[model samples]
Target: MSDAPIRVLVCDDQALVRTGYVTIFSAQPDMEVVGEAGNGHEAVSAAQRLHPDVVVMDIRMPLLDGIEATRKLAGPEVVEPPKVLVVTTFNVDAYVYDAFRAGASGFLLKDSPPAELVAGIRTVARGEALLAPTVTRHLIGRFAERLRPADTARPGRADLVRALTARELEVLELIAEGLSNAEIAAALFISPETVKTYVSRILTKLGLRDRVQAVVLAYRVGLVTAAD
Candidate 1:
């Protein structure tokens, strides 16, 4: 929101890819390319050193993978972690959920348009989790079968249900369903600001880093399902 350009660190194994990202990001007047990382190890080290507002990370890399690097930079134990925006190819869509679990704030397909990638970085920089509809659908389709079992009484369900009010639960369900704050407000007949308040409360109560974790928890607790 401030005039300060959003600081970004691009991390990938391929030189060409990193160069491409730098070019695109540098074109944005509101964004700054603070640094670059060739692998996950360098990503973590560089991120620690640069403290960029957002990290553009590739899921596959040498030494440490992007997932582990994301964890090191933004995991729950981290203090004041920078937001991570993971970029993946179709072959690695299966790792999408794992990246979110590892503390990624958002993800984009490797072939995503330059505009989309730029917007993703901005979204995460603003402390928003960017789970596009296609990405969410892919996540459910890829892992839903394994996530579901006949028994729905998973551990931590009771605590989660008890921790949130009915409205907060509804908001969480909408979040898991991939609705934006405006969409959730429309669906619930509440103002967008009100929806945001509910979201903040939900995150605080759940101790989640962001809405990505909220969605994962919703699936893990049987609150929202692939069928839904």
Candidate 2:
């Protein structure tokens, strides 16, 4: 990791929400809140100017909305993109799908513990995705349900599946089923620390940044079918 502190930009229409995030992040020695915005358009502009490492974006912001802001900042068009961690109030919000599709690196509920928020920002800043499997499955299920049948044919899926080892493949399936690390360890008869190691190795071997990317890869490769 780089020696620089992880710079963050908090984007939320609610002033209190922004202030709360600022307070929480400012207390971290390794994190710095570089800027703030109250809407999506401002968020895009701030990202371009400030070049923060991570953006804590609210999904329902006015002007452009967090999904569009995320796309503009981290979309495929950009040569170098800042990581976006979407903030939502609901666990199963439909906008979460749009946020992921728009290149968001992670999702955090508004009521998430302060530590989880800090960890999420750091994880995304470190080039990792921070999707919980349950949240991921919910997002994918919603996406697949709305997808047209003609778009189901994803290319390069076979190669991705062939890339996984037997153990890694097992872990991937369990992940799709929405098992937490502790639960996954118990299910696999392994230690939680071992599970974390396997998860990290899986991310590296698969060339996936985080669990969110892993879920997307799993869906794209048909390793975990939408129906499953």
Best candidate (score: TM-score): 1
List RMSD in Å for every model shown: 3.8, 4.0
lDDT of 2 by residue, 39-106 (tens): 99999999999999899999988989898999899764566889999988866666777777677888
- Candidate 1 lDDT over 63-145, as tens digits, reads 99999999899877787989999998844655876776677899889999999999999888866678776667568545644
Worst 10 residues of 2 by lDDT: 145-154
Please provide TM-scores, in order, for all candidate models, with all chains considered together. 0.85, 0.76
Q: CA lDDT of each candidate?
A: 0.83, 0.79
> Candidate 1: deviation at residue 130, Å?
2.5
Write out the backbone clash pairs for model 1.
none
lDDT of 2 at 221: 66
Q: Which residue pairs in model 2 clash with each other?
A: 129-210
